[model samples]
Target chain A: MQAQDLTTEVAGLSVHLLRGGEGDPAVVLHHSTGPIGWVPFHDELAQRFAVHAVDLPGYGRSDRPSWARHPRDLAILLNRALEQLEMDGVTLIGAGFGGFVAAEMAAMTDARLRSLVLVGAAGIQPAEGEILDQMVLKEEFYVQKSFRDEESFRAFYGEDETGELADLWDFSREMTARVTWRPYMFDRRLPHILATVRTPTLLVWGEEDRVIPRSCAELYARALPNAQLEIVPEAGHVAEYEQPETVARLIAEHVGSLA
Target chain B: MFISYFTERPYQDEQGEYINTLDLAKSNADYNPVLGGDLYHRYLDEKVYAEEMGFDGLVLNEHHSMPACMGGVINVEASILARITKRARIVLAGNVLPIWDDPLWLAETLAMIDVISRGRLVCGWVRGTGRESVTHNTPSPYNWERYQEAHDLIMKAWTEPGPFRWEGEHFDYRYVNPWPRPLQQPPPIWIPGSLSKATVKWAAERQFPYLMLATEHEPTKRSFEYYDACAREAGHETGSQHRGYLFKVHVDETEELAEQTARKFLQGPSNPFLEGNQGQVRGFMQNLPGMNSRTEVLPTIETWAPAVARGAQRQHKKILEKKKMAKGKDRDYSGSYEEQIAKYTIIAGTPDQVVEKIRNVLEYLRPGIIAIWDGDGAMSHEDTMRALRLLGEEVIPRVREIGKELDLHSPFEVSPVTNKPVAEAVGVG
Candidate 1:
């Protein structure tokens, strides 16, 4: 499926809503580099759930509003986008930095978030091995040090065999630059807020991931009383891109089980 | 003016044979699940230690997907260097600015570094080596033109009255002002090149320094002559005052020991194992007018190897397999200390001999500055420290003495810290 299949709008200052996918309401938030065209995984998820992918303010097609100073401001702007979409009683799936936003939404909002699924999510304060510090400060650091193999690089990037790998590579780099480009992940208080998220969560991680290490998954799984951990082998940081079928099946099953 | 070792210490594998650059880069992949943070921290630590050792400046450069040269992002190194050495000048000896989406960010980042370090920043601009720009998705047809435009934009952003608009062929901006102004009045600018007439002329027009890599002495001398005449015609003073050269140096207790050390070092496997990658270098240089001509520019491995092999066959009345082996081995010396120094493009000797040889070069070239590339081939930390000590203590002082004889002034003079001059003579501004 092409990204053109999805329609988008500015839900608030620096925030955009990509509307498509029909079923039980599922809010899909993207990582940094902004709102992208719909992926096959998003399409698959759309088959069973109404999907709403958000472009955080200052990224993607969203406006770079001056009011959005930090990640909390981003969290507030994300909440407003949900309000604009009139989205309630939804399952939230966040990837990379988007996962941080999803976790924040689950923790703070009184909205009806049925469940949370964080795929290669980044928000928890990592005490030991924090890739965020390096990723945010120096992009080349991540590019040079992250991927283990050519396959891993290609997979995490989510480029298909269509020779559009060049464009996708540029997009992946730009996305990384946009999200972690400033003050990095978010305020240190974010991990403390993770404890308040009562939503039943699924922590999905790529075994070969470098952006957010697999060890971080164990931390999140331990912190959230109701969270489950699934390790996808042979995948890097972007597990959804690498193992979309498995990720989709897992998500579908998880959401169904919640019912 | 500065010498920093490009350490390849990590290439040492289990068998003690130095691994190729490609394998070294790939080796990190094995630890991808665990050691990313440690590797990054170690990289930073190396740069920080370089500052503590008291080099005039720290150097970081960019190369992509090449194992021999792992510094893929020069800016990242610059950032780390800036944080550690708050007072020392951080020189990114020409980032391939043309490949970037916005060179203004480079200017802005440099400005921020200047502010953070209170003005100890020097910016170098370059068009980059051939074929490397392809990975950045930069248009090869317009590389030189884009480089020129990017250089101008960054300069204007740094020097011009800001909040002004900038509309250019490549960039359009309504607000041209960038925060954190550079402290050095204007941070010093240096341009590094080998055989580009356009680059030479540009540096000449601006009266900025030109850093020449070690090429054949005749062509290098001729290039400097052309640079001198051009600078003079432009009504600018010309001499070694702004001319520097980058060369590899290996010092040992004796000449024999130095050669032995170099041979052992050269025997290590080459980094960057990709096939057809060497064509990138050839394709890049072939585009430049003077460099495009095989005879005009100095011969590299591509031109030199087959010729030498053919010559050896003619001499022996048969194709000697050993000659081919030698040629292959020579090609692998792209990152070797011995090959670089033995060619006299770089200098290898005991500290005393190195000092004497450098003095000879100064007499012949009269360059204003001398930049030493001690960082190559994963040089050991201890060896690098020793080289720095010898350079700072022995070589630099001797060079200064020679400068006195030539009536050349030192480029660096102490910044007047106290207001004694204006305070006593006139009121402070």
Candidate 2:
């Protein structure tokens, strides 16, 4: 099936949704650090499952509610929007900061979610010495530590500096600032809340992830009774960007098994 | 050998506008300076364009906190290139692996790229420049040792049979196996250098390709000789068996126009040390020890300017200084344009002249492969395209003819067109 086009709404503090495919429902949440442009995982899954990718309330084309306190509030609002759209029984896929909201939504909502895919998911506070804040924030630092060679960096980020899609990142960064302005991360109770999520979970983390440590993926795996872990080789927090095909394949296989 | 073009903005006016050596550099800020989207787009086009042009291999390198050289995060470039050029051989002429305490992560990411590109990976090991190492707080004195160990460990993960224990000074691991084995058995290895003894000897012993960036004839010749001699002494084959050079290239209709453009773009009021000299020397020393010694051998800036000025008066004085300090025998930068054309070592002429020069270099070096390093000093897109179009349509065919005459295997082949539509495939594009 062809990929769906993007549509918008004003329900529960305005949200933009890109709908695609037509089968078992899958709700895709983009990272707070970027727009809700469905990553490769969601794109691949769209071939089978009916996919609903939503821009967070404050990100992409979504209207930001001034009263929205944190990502959890955004998550609650997403739950309300899902209800309005009647997209039930979704296999929720959340990456980075989006994972934080997915965890909260899983805990607070009673909606039917088939499963959950958390990629380099962020929510739990990292152990001392395991998390390196300085390395994560600086582009040079992360490039030096995460990528093995210049080619890998080029592969992760496109080689061109003057292409049409180049400026898409500017909008991404602006969206990130809007959602995660005050504190980049969420509450410390995120893991405790995630533990209550009984949805079948698949945790995929980059072995070289500096933003959220791999150990944290392990922690999430242990916390969720139905969770399984897959470590992407040679990737950072943005594994979908670096090794999209591999990540897509994994998602397809896992989601296919459930179907 | 893989060739990746690097673009740099060498000249900065007091008003903050950068003038490029090659007209192509202007594109870096042409679309939108603050947004940086245009610059990124141009880079992507270049990589895809290079692949379509039929380069045997393409390369990308890393640098940080410098405007002159803007490829701060090369992985970003590589990831995009992988999607655009699914068939071309891609080389990350290196990642400064030593700076990161955990290099395994890099190994994993490269392995993923290898998978994505279907195994066309050329691994380049580097111990970043002094300025970068200092700024990042990565140990400099032991960078070489760290780089060597990292190389050994990563290779083991890529090639060796599974899950072995790895214990080294910098990194210690109980399990050393990596998944998704690279497609090209052991991916080809190339070491970039300005002229470092340690790197030359290491590459020579292993018979890996040697890449000389921004190098001159005299020092480059000595380096080739040294590599050859070392290989011979070690009972290994050498010479052009695995040697390549990287230089800023610009080809126009006339030599005078190209030189004039180069001079106008490369000159301006930028600080020599910050803008050019120190980074060049420091990058050489840290990554290539042999180049450090060579830097001491060549003539100093004051002495070499007069000599080079006679030939190319518009040349950057600091560049001449660095060239003078380079070590190596066969110091032959003197000759009429025609005489230099006869040498064919550097391509800096019209299409025919450039083609002739490449043929001569190929004949003289007889190296297995050559990489054209065309990125430097803010070469503009228009000029780059002109050179690329000329080379693809003219220079490459002539070089193939020369290779045939010499009974050498052609380095590239045009892939046949497929019947399938691109939009239908899964990750095929």
Candidate 3:
């Protein structure tokens, strides 16, 4: 399944959207390192639900409005875009830093969101260890540490030279700094507001994840009143990007249960 | 001609080993408190002396996580200089605008300096270099925007009457009423740039004296001309007062002694990290992706592309050309220091010889203001004191004569010191 590029305006800023799949809308919110093209995980989920992979403001080709300076601002902007797109009953899946943004939207909005799936997410600060600040880490090292498959690491490094990929790397880092630099990644008030998110949540984790500790996943599971935890074996922080088939299988089952 | 004193306050100790410039976290092992303490105090003493030497101003700049200078907060030093120096403009060339989360503090602090200095504060705003971006982790693209907003906010806080709310793009303040406001009304604002057309044109448009830092004769002329063209386009003709040049110059009683002292600049010791900065973790961290737009980065790319690419052609000369010293090809100044002096990068000789070199530089660049650096790297404090002695007793006064003959109007001469009121309560002239 091939995904097509799209652009939409929200709050006077241009949003870069890549749409594919069919059926109900499944929004894929990417990590801090902004998503450019569709990944394998999107394709796997596309079989059941239409996927709308968005480049968050200041990430990928999207124009970063000056006012989107906080995580809440990003949440508001994303929700505005979805509302303009007339998307309803959408299954929201967010990965890494995107998870932080996703959790905020889930807390505030009720009518549009059907379910929430957080993968190796970052929102709750864990007791044992905090999420690793990825700004200082080299690109190749980040990809290597985030993946369980050695081939996946090698393939990512092999093709990173193209100019577009380099720009995405920069956008992701800058936007991350804009929203997450001060409080680190997690919103301090999120845990108290978790109960507001009426939709069921599924927390997916990479068993070998090191970027954000597995402790965060357990924290999310404990905090959310209606949530389940599923840790995939031999995967890291980017569990979906590393093991898309396994993550998709869990997400698909979760969607079925929700329906 | 406006003569000023500048230094990076090097942490001169041989015990510490070289570390990577980019990875500042891991690279901080080189610092020794004993050395740092001695250096910071001495820099203050040097500023006091610069004021005593009848120099028009003292230039204090900001840099982070570098062993070469301890000026992480320039205003702290400026505040001290306010109380200490009786005369001489406290020229901050200048505070890095993007790093400060609260520009209100900056407005208040500079106001305090202006009050204490009895209305002698020349504020210079700079975007800072790439090293600063990574060290502070400020977004590169916003360097321009933040600098603009921060500048506007400070100006508003100073000029706009009590308690006006500011809702700028980068900064939002409910109330901006700085107590103990600046004495100089709108203190003389200066900006330093290389070949950056944006900065040069901005300075021209705003009527700020654009100070060119150690750029070669040709590039400096082109930049000056560009500023002139900008001023003309904006409906005013620019003069010598619009241009200022800074040089790393050394003067002693003997030629050999002068060359030895002046040659340290080629070392590019400015990086703080003894190792090269390119492609390193800090380099990537500072440069990130959008920190600088292509247009913003073009001038730098044009300047350093060939030298960085033709690395093989770089000879054993430790000291590279100033043009090659921007960001990419930070060539370590090595080899025949005498040869580099001949390249005219560093003006070194007897007092008479140094005067001739200064005249040549002034003629080629024709700047109304000139800042000189007499210390860095291995150059000792005594060497700096001696260099200053020659500059004050001999170089500065002579330059004044030459400047008069050349009609190089200082910023003071072009726009005479007319008191700009901070508030209506302060009584406007």
Show how many residue pairs clash in every candidate, following the order shown.
Answer: 14, 53, 11
Candidate 1 ranges beyond 4 A from true positions: A1-259, B1-54, B253-257, B264-342, B408-429
Top candidate (lDDT): 3
User: Deviation in angstroms for A94 in model 1?
Assistant: 47
Fraction of native contacts, model 2: 0.00
Residues B309-356, model 3: lDDT tens digits: 112112111123334443333432323455446656577888899889
iRMS for model 1? 13.1
Q: Lowest summed lDDT over 10 consecutive residues: which window, candidate 1 chain A?
A: A132-141
> Cα lDDT for residue B187, model 1?
78
Q: Point out the higher-scoring one by DockQ: 2 or 3.
A: 3
Candidate numbers sorted by DockQ from highest down: 3, 1, 2
TM-score of chain A of 2: 0.82
How do these models rank on TM-score, best leading?
3, 1, 2
| lDDT by candidate, in order shown | 0.59, 0.59, 0.74
Candidate closer to the true structure by lDDT (higher is better), 1 or 3:
3
Docking class of 1: incorrect
TM-score of chain A of each: 0.81, 0.82, 0.94
lDDT of each residue in B1-429, candidate 1, tens digit only? 233343432332324333433221334443332333444455566556655555566665566544454467766667766767654566667688777778778888888877777777777887765335534655444556678888888888888878888787667778888887777657777787665566777788787777776444555677777777767787776655567666556666677855654344343334322121111122212231111122322222232322221121121212223245444334433443434555465577777888787777767776656666653444444555556666666666666677677644323421111212223423332
Candidate 3, residue A101: the lDDT equals 85
